[model samples]
Target: MKKAALYLLLITLFSKILGFTREIVLSHMYGASNISDAYIVSTTVPTFIFSFLGVAIATSYIPIYSTIENEKGIQSANIFTNTLVHFVILICTLLIIVAFVFTTPIVKLFASGFDKKTLSLAVLFTKISIFSIYFIGLIYVFNSYLQIKGKFVIPACIGFLFNFVIITSIILSDFFNILMLPIGYVLSYILQFLFLLPFLRKHKYKYKYSFIIDKDTSYYMKRIFYLSLPGIFGASVNEINSIVDRTIASRISVGGISALNYAINLNSFIQGLFVLTITTVMYPIISKMVVESDVDGVKKSLNKAINSITLLVIPITIGSMIFSEPLINFLFGRGAFDSKALSMTSEALFFYSIGMIGFSLRELLSRVFYAFQDTKTPMINAAIAIFMNIVLSIILSRYLEIGGLALATSISAIFCTLLLFINLRNKIGSFEIRNIIISFVKVLCASLLMGMISRFFYYALLNNINDNLCLVLSVCIGAITYLVIIYFMRIKEINIIVNVIKKKLFSSFNVL
Candidate 1:
């Protein structure tokens, strides 16, 4: 289990690095312009669709498929796969049509502050990007299948390829002087779908049209819908919160949307690398344990996940907070992204970084409930968080501009995390509360030390060279310092990561 998590984490980390590089390219090419804002708003539509449908499929189907795989074996699981693929394809197609037809209204709904030209651009981007929905849905199903089959490497690398395609498209747009942004996203999804075809073929899992839902299939589907309903609600909360931020930011200035988007992108990159990787690796394992009624095993896995997440994320969050300005300037200082944009984005990133641990915890703990097939608790909590976010965002945006939006999100995430943890303890009877507390203390202390080291190095580098090189140097020094401190602390979990790399290296050498 540790090995699997480590492998997935390394691949996820690589993908995130590529994703960040993609962001850097986007910053240079588009900066914090109205076009970038339109691109951001346009991308949100498919993403919102994905969060609503794709998340439901992933959360509901993984445990259901795992259960079938465990009890009835491979053939039964394949049936489930075929049924789900057909269902998702139909649903995604319908959604694409709805999105296309309502593109203008939907864009206006999300970006209410946009004027006529910006609204038209957002609508155009959304219309173009909606074509990727079915392909995106197909990729999700295939990726989940690969994950359940223990083929983590390919699934992890697939997202990196998607980012690569987007980066290429952005470059092409610059050369042609045409808005090829949405085209890049569409092509990426197509490529992602195509890339998984061979794997599906190897597994002999061909997509078939099956409108005939049997009693048993319908039963499972209904169960899935019940389980996934909360996720949909939760996703709605997120979308609403995003719309609130974008709307408020849109009122601020032309680049307001872009600033918020850049900061949020950075936040997503971190969460995807650490939080998503941990949750993905753990969810199936947790589900299997739940199926077997291994309560102790569940507790043990939960503890390890919590410890592992805190050990990695605390330092990164603190370091990012301490060196936020340089990091932002280093990565996005060039092109139309000016010093003012960097400052605004850096401020948002600092506050957002404070919520990293909260978001990471939320991801892992929410899955714990999902593994137990209890999604309603998370849904209820998400509703509360969403309400808090909207109320606070409206009240705060009046004073703090875009930074207020980011701050509101951070506050809401922390609130959600606390609520989830408390409710999880009640549901599970008891957790490793003592260990969690102690481990968090250790990680926090270590993070503080690392933050100081990062700050010192950041200032020193800034004094020497206020350019991209200094930004790069500061990140390196901060990372090295954090690792060294953690090493001296003898965090045993770190060895798990090291061993996985060693195994991969040996496997590669043997192939050579």
Candidate 2:
């Protein structure tokens, strides 16, 4: 488990760095302009479709696949995989048809206030992106298989291909003056799917066409669908909140969607770094424990996962919130994105950062229920949270513009996290509630101190040199200060992390 976690973390870290570079390139090439907004809007529909289907498959696939592995061994798992692949292919085909038919309506729904040109561009982009939906869906199944087989590195490395494709496309677009954005997106998914082919071949995962679903396969599918129903609602809630933000932001100003997208990209970067790494590594472990009825193990793993994620996420969130302006200016204050764009994006980033811890917690906690094969409860909580988000976005957009959309998301996440925890406690019988609370308080206090130090140094550096160099230096100083404070606080979780790092280093050296 430690090895898997470390491998996934390393790959996620590398991928996230590349992903961040992709964002920087996009910002440099397009800035927060109508073109960028159009591209964002166009990508949004495909992403939404992908997430809905991807979430369904990912949430259902692992547990069922794991169950098959336990019951009938590798052969059964392969059979299940073949069935699922065929099913997914059919579903994806239908989805593509739907996307093609409703592209204009969907584009208008998401980007309602866009000008004719931007709307047309967005519709075109959406249509292009729809081509990748099936490919991405197939990739999800392959990834789930790899993950269950404990080959974390390959699955995590897939994102690097995505970033490379996007960055290359963005660069080419500069010279070609073409809408290479969707082409980049389609290529990335294709490559993402292609990357797994060798592994699938090595594993001997054949794609046999069999409409015959065995009893066991049927049973598992029923279970998965039943478990996944609530997740559909839950996932829909989350996606709808995002769509609402875009809709509201579309109404606000020309660059509103782009500004929110920039901020969200940064948020996702941080999340990919900390939250995603841990959750991805933890979920299968949690699933196995639940399958084995190892309640104690499940509790232990959950506690460790939560603590591990929170300790890292809290500080990063605080730092981002503190130095959002400098970070935004440094990465995106050039080319078409000017000081005004930076200011707006930074504000959205700051507000989004406030929900970072909640978002991270939500990922960890939601997976706990998933491990227990209970997706409905989280779905219900997600529904309430989504409702809150829509209401808050509508009310706040009138007053706060794009920033309010971000704030609404943060507020909704907070509500969702709280509800998930409460429900999880009831389901699990008990949790490390007191310990989590105490650890969170300690981390929060330390983060507040770090935030103050970061703010002081950031402003002081601004006075000295207000260029990108100073911005970079400010981030370095802030990060160092935050880590130093966290270390001195003797956070117990830090010790666990250090021990793991030492073990991995020594183990690698021995291998060498």
Candidate 3:
């Protein structure tokens, strides 16, 4: 498990580096402008649709795939996959066509605050961007299969290829900037989908034209649909939240949608680095364990994941809050992104980062629940959170604008995480709740000290040093302070981290 997590972590880290580069380029080129706003809003239709239906399929398909392969055999599993793939493609393609024809109304629904001109531009972009969902939908199917086979590396690193192509597309957009942007997204999605074909071929997973569904396929398909019903609702919670935020943001100003996107993207980049990496690596194992009725194994896996995420995310969350401005300035304060844009983006980042721990735990916890095939619990939890978020967002946005939207998201996340944890505990009995709380207390102490130290250093070097250098130094100071304090304090979570590092290092040495 540690080894698989390490592979996923390293590859995800690499992809995130390139993804970071991609965001920087996009921010510099477009800033929080109308064009950027329209572009983001344009993609919302496809994003919302794919995130729900597409992600639902991917999230629920893997465990069933494992079950079928175990019970029915690989040939049966392949046929199941082939038929499933064709069905998803056919459905998504039809959806895309409908979305294309009705682009204007969809974009308007997505961003009702857009003016005539911006709405027109968004409609155009939507026409182009919606097609990418076809590839994205296909990618989800392939991703489930790969992860089931314990093929984490390539699936993990494919985002690197996606980012590389996106970077190239952004560079080429100079000649026809606005129109080229969405086209680039489509091209990258295409390439990403194509890149996975070789893996399928290598595994001899043929397409087999699966129109006639056998009994086994029908059984699994029916189960997949049953599982996917709640999965869809659970997954759509965030999409629903984003839609609410974007709609409210659109009322703020022309660039409201763009500012929100930039902030959320930055937050996602950080979360992807560690939180997501752990959860992604754990999902398959957790699912398989649940299938095998390994209750203790599942508990151990969840605890380890929670500890790792909490330990790593504490420093990042606190550090980001302290140095939000410098971080934003360093990453995106140039080109079309001005001082005002940086300030708003940084403010949003601060609010969003405040809930990092909650978000991290929620990521892991939700998967654990999914492993138990109890998606309804999470769906209910998300429905409650979304209600809270909507009420909070409407009331708060009047004052905080983008920051309010983000703050509402944080509050809802923390609420969702708490409820999920309590429910999981009640459902599974107990296993070191007291210890987990103690570790969090220790982490909080360390993070507080790190935040103070980083803030002090940031202000001290404000005008004296290069902006980038100063930002880097401040972050280093915070991270080092947090790690040193945790180490000296002898926190329990620190040891897990130490062991992971030790194992990773020894493995590297053996390979060399």
Candidate 4:
């Protein structure tokens, strides 16, 4: 488990860095203009339409697959898998057809503030990119299957190919026709599906030509379908909020959507690199524990996962708040990313950072509910958050504009995470909430101190040194300072990590 988590972290980190490069390329070529906005909406439309299904499939499939394998055996499970693949492909095809026919209205729903030219481009892009749902659905199923099979490497590496394809396409689009952008976006997913096929076969996963919907398969399909409905709505909370943000942003300014997208990507980087790596590794294990009726084990894993997220996310959040502008400027200040774009993106990043820990916790907690096969709690809680976000966004955007949209997102996440905690205790009894709070307090203190020093260093060196160099050094210094404070504070999670590193070093020395 440790090795799998670490491997995933490394892969995610590397892929995310490449993914950031992809964003940088996009920003350089297009900035936060109508062209970029149109392209972003085109890509976002499919995700907005289908991501709930994707999340629902992944969250619901894991435990269901485990149950079938345990009771009916691997052959039965494989048949169920075949049935699911066929069913998902059929559903995706239908969705694609519908989306294609209503592409303009769908584009309008996501980006209503678009002018005729921008709206037309978005519609065109959506027409081509909508087919990605087919690949996206299959990828989700295969990814869960591989994770269940304990083959994490290939699933983790797909992002590499996906990002590479995207970056290449963006560059080509710049040099040649802009149509290459959406064309490349669709091609990336196709390549990712192809990339996973051989690995699936290697893991003894065969694709049966026959789609069996026998009694057993039918029962499991019904189970997955029921579970997925709530999961879809539960997962859709975030996507729905995103659609709201983009729609509202479109009304705010020309580059509003692009600014939000860039900032959100930066915020997502932290969640993706740490929170996701932890959850992806722990989700399968926790699902098995649930199958074994290991409630205590589930509780223990949830505590550790939450603590890990807090320890990882809090300091980064503080740093992001302090250095939002510098980070955005450092990364995207060049080329077409002008001063106005910089200010909008930085403002968005700062506000988004406020809810970074909340978002991370909500993600982990939601996964726990899903592992226990209780999606309804999260769905209800998400609905509550969605209401809060919408209300706050309307009120705040009136004042804060882009920042208001972002702050509303953070506030909603924090509130939703709090509700999940209360309901989670009611659902599973106390899962060491006291310890989590204690640890969080310590992490927050350490992070605050680190942020102050980092901010000091940043400002002190601003006049004497290059902006990028100063920002990089200040971040490095902040990281070191954070490590020192946590070490002295003897944070339990940090110590565990320290000891693990020590062991690896000692083992390597012995090998030498």
Among these predictions, the greatest lDDT belongs to 4
lDDT of 1 by residue, 437-500 (tens): 8778877887898778767776777767855676677667777877787777766677666677
lDDT of 4 by residue, 1-512 (tens): 77899889999999999999999999999999999999999999887777888899899899998888888888888888888888889989999999999999999999889999999988998899998999999999999999988878789899999999999999999889999999999999999999988777763665443655656688889999899998888988889888889999999999999999999999988899999999999999999999999999999989988888898999999999999998999999999999999999999999999999889999998988998899999999999999999999999999999999999999999999999999999989999999999999999999999999999998999999999999999999999999999899988888888899999999999999
Pairs with backbone N, CA or C atoms under 3 Å apart (clashes), candidate 2: none
Candidate 4 residue 374 C-alpha distance from true site, Å: 0.7
Question: What is candidate 2's TM-score against the reference?
Answer: 0.95
When sorted by lDDT, best at the front, the candidate numbers are: 4, 3, 2, 1
State the lDDT of candidate 3 residue by residue for 72-144, as single tens digits: 7888888889878877988898889899889898888888898888888899988999998888898999988
Better of 1 and 2 by TM-score: 2
Looking at candidate 3, what is the lDDT of residue 239?
85
Q: Report the backbone clash tally of model 3.
A: 0
Assess the local accuracy of residue 309 in candidate 1 as a C-alpha lDDT between 0 and 100: 87
In candidate 2 the C-alpha lDDT for residue 485 amounts to 76
Cα RMSD to native, each candidate? 3.0, 2.3, 2.2, 1.1
CA displacement after TM-score superposition, residue 40 of candidate 4 (Å): 0.4
* Per-model TM-score on C-alpha atoms: 0.93, 0.95, 0.95, 0.98
Select the stronger candidate by TM-score from 2 and 4: 4
**Model 3 weakest lDDT span, ten residues long:** 203-212
Task: Quote the RMSD, in angstroms, for model 2.
Answer: 2.3
Off by over 4 Å in 1: 204-215, 235-237, 488-512
